[model samples]
Target: MAKQQLAVLITLLAFLGPAACQQQGLHICFNGWLKVPPLLSYLLCPPGSRTTNPPPSPSPNPAPPSGAGLSYDYYNNNGSSSYCPSAESLVKDAVKKAIDMDPGVGAGLIRLFFHDCFVRGCDASVLLNTTTSKDSPTDTEREGPPNKNSLRGFEVIDAAKAAIEATCPGTVSCADIVAFAARDASSLLSYGKINMKMPGGRLDGRVSFANETDQLPGPFSSLAQLQSSFREKGLSSDEMVTLSGAHSIGKAHCGFFSDRLPPNPSTMDYAFATELEVKCQGNEANMVHQDYQTAYVLDNKFYQNVRANKVLFDSDDVLKTVREVKQNAEYPEIWERKFEKAMENLGRIVDVKSRREGEIRETCWRVNGAGY
Candidate 1:
């Protein structure tokens, strides 16, 4: 293992230059890639090749996992079992292109992954489409109130699925594709700061119900409600706070937080609310970002935004009261490490599929045609 690590470090140095490596042995970690300790070269990935940008390498005393789950490694877990090794790359490329055109898509994919996993596990049941023919298509998760029009980036997922299907037809699951796309978005949005190696092997689920989306937490949810919802899913308060940091790249529809508008101090900053009122004036459907600082970057800035009462949702503002959550606002690195683990936990809420219940759907928006 030492030899292999040395070889990898040599390769990294060759690319990073000896001065950068020898002068600062730790330079490799912060050279705009996710950092690994002393010699975890395998974890080092190129910016274009990965989904999230990473910071400095792990400390001697690394923080513990946010919740129990598999170790992080985008390369090893991409096509779990070698089913389609290029699955991760394909999704990453597609997401990169889409996000390049519009950074907002990256945030949308992240939210999509959360909605898919929270309701019915990370089964991609949320991707199932509504009825088409006069046959009255059965209701799917897409129709749920939380999803309906709010969920964006379906086309991005479609493009990725098409790319994967062409190369390794019927091998990669739609569920995994959604996970991969979101994973890539993290890297791109963070500009290579968060590189989460997602564990694949998920199987696309056939079932989806509009009503099931109620399982998802709401923007108006109180802290107790948020804690209860996350706890039900095996996520801790710390993990909840870490995941909420995703707001750094996220936006909300006017209706989602309009209730907190001016003259109605709903724990929101009066000035921030007024600013939103102006932007949203006469446009009921306008969208707003919570992280006014770096709306497109994925980091801990949202915690700070929460501190200033500049956030859009009650769910976000309520977090400011938590001492630990507030602390995360002060230290970006501390929250980022936890974010990686929390994301892995969210993706693995359900185990890999079985032939009886799961299959690699040919497309993401619908189940396979005809009889099994």
Candidate 2:
């Protein structure tokens, strides 16, 4: 009777699929011929029924499928460990060293990672320089107005890459290096408050175009615009809010947000607006901290400031009106936890639709054999 029931259950699950099994409040475990749901496991298998230990626990960070042409163990596959204790540690140390030399580098690294991943699946194409004429409107990604003078930390990435190359020698991909540096930069800037382990194995992309810069969300985007932008990148609304917390540690150029100053601005704090106007008067290049309370720290103060309408960017200010984000704003601890998970998700999204399409460039700035 038990054998008959087990066979029937297996047949049912065969057609139901994993999603259906989960919806029925049961965990699916595939073991060759036997498709056992957790609820029925004890009854079917009994005590020591043709078994060799229980199923393994789910991996905390599972590698994407091989067809994706990327692996979390990319460094291991490339023998990076044979060269050093751990390539990730080497990269982390290099990032810390760079930050030590320039305290303001964290924000740029974070932004660089964000921009790179958003446009082209984190292939590190953003690092490529324009092969076309410099004056041409169709310059490289770095030459776009949104990034022309604002995006930074390329030198820090180059430094970290040089250090990694000295140890691994063509083993690490620039995309993975950028991801690692960004993770380390966030943790270092936040005083070890937002650290998360990053998985490696990303490849570098060959193409970079200036016009693609328009895909990135701007400082003046509205709440709906921000949501649409993040969604287009496969990030959730919660993730969007969590990632936006990065604004806590960065500064913005006056030209980016100065328009909010004139014509009787209402969303901004009176004193803050006046200060910005005075500081930015006739000088669009002046920069100001995004979060005044904890400009250098990478904490939840950005959320607090957004709630108080003290944020620098119009897009950030609009987050308060987002119901889900507004609710999370009142609880910084929740945001921190969500932020960590969201950042992990951010790294994962960099892998989607990005395999076998590019190569690991010998140098980040130019394609291999392209000549200086």
* Top TM-score model: 2
Question: Which stretches of model 2 miss by more than 4 angstroms?
Answer: 1-73, 77-85, 131-138, 263-265, 351-354
Index of the highest-lDDT prediction: 1
Q: TM-scores for all candidates?
A: 0.75, 0.76
Residue lDDT tens for model 2, 1-372: 698997897766556544342332122221111223344543443322312222222432233222244445556654444233467877788788878887678889988988888776788878988443343344678976567888888987787778778876776778888888888998899887777766676788766777566557677655655665566666766678889999988788887777667624457887878878887885879998888877878888887777776777777888887666665667767777777777766766554444455676778888666776
Where does candidate 2 clash, by residue pair? none
**C-alpha RMSD by candidate, in order:** 20.5, 17.8
Q: What is candidate 1's local distance difference test score?
A: 0.71
Give Cα distance to truth, residue 307, candidate 2, Å: 1.3
lDDT of 2: 0.69
For candidate 1, which ten residues in a row score worst on lDDT? 47-56
